[model samples]
Target: MTMSLGPYASFIVTSYAAAAIVVAILIGWVVLDYRNQARRLRELDRSGVTRRSGRSAVDTP
Candidate 1:
């Protein structure tokens, strides 16, 4: 049931919807990246990989 929107109402609705979609995409990307990074760190720790040859943790960071 699509009804006619008053003049400029359609524009406002479109703009708000576009803004919402962009914000949602940005938030999802950030969350996914964070999770992936955390998972990688855990895996590295569990693998018994300690100390880089001739390189300190400070150097890696």
Candidate 2:
């Protein structure tokens, strides 16, 4: 079987590609930010800072 995108094929394809690119960028940004925040928290913990709950930032539980 075969399908057609009609006259607006290029526009449709471009729109989909742009959306995918945007989503990929956002995901990458989130992952990098998470790693940075984790590192900062570890630093604070090492300096003797603790959360309000009295738990160390690096504590697992």
Candidate 2 segments exceeding 4 Å error = 55-61
TM-score of 2: 0.82
Q: lDDT by residue for model 1 over 1-61, one digit each (tens)?
A: 9877779898989999999999999999999999999899789879976647769778987
Model 2, 1-61: lDDT tens digits are: 8779999999999999999999999999999999999999999999998787766679755
**Among all candidates shown, the one with the greatest lDDT:** 2
In order of appearance, the predictions have TM-scores of 0.64, 0.82
Which sections of candidate 1 miss by over 4 Å? 1-6, 50-61
Provide backbone clash counts, one per model.
Answer: 0, 0
Judge candidate 1 at residue 26 and give its lDDT. Answer: 100
| Candidate 1 global CA lDDT score | 0.89
Clashing pairs in 2: none
In order, the Cα lDDT scores of the candidates are: 0.89, 0.94
Worst 10 residues of 2 by lDDT: 52-61
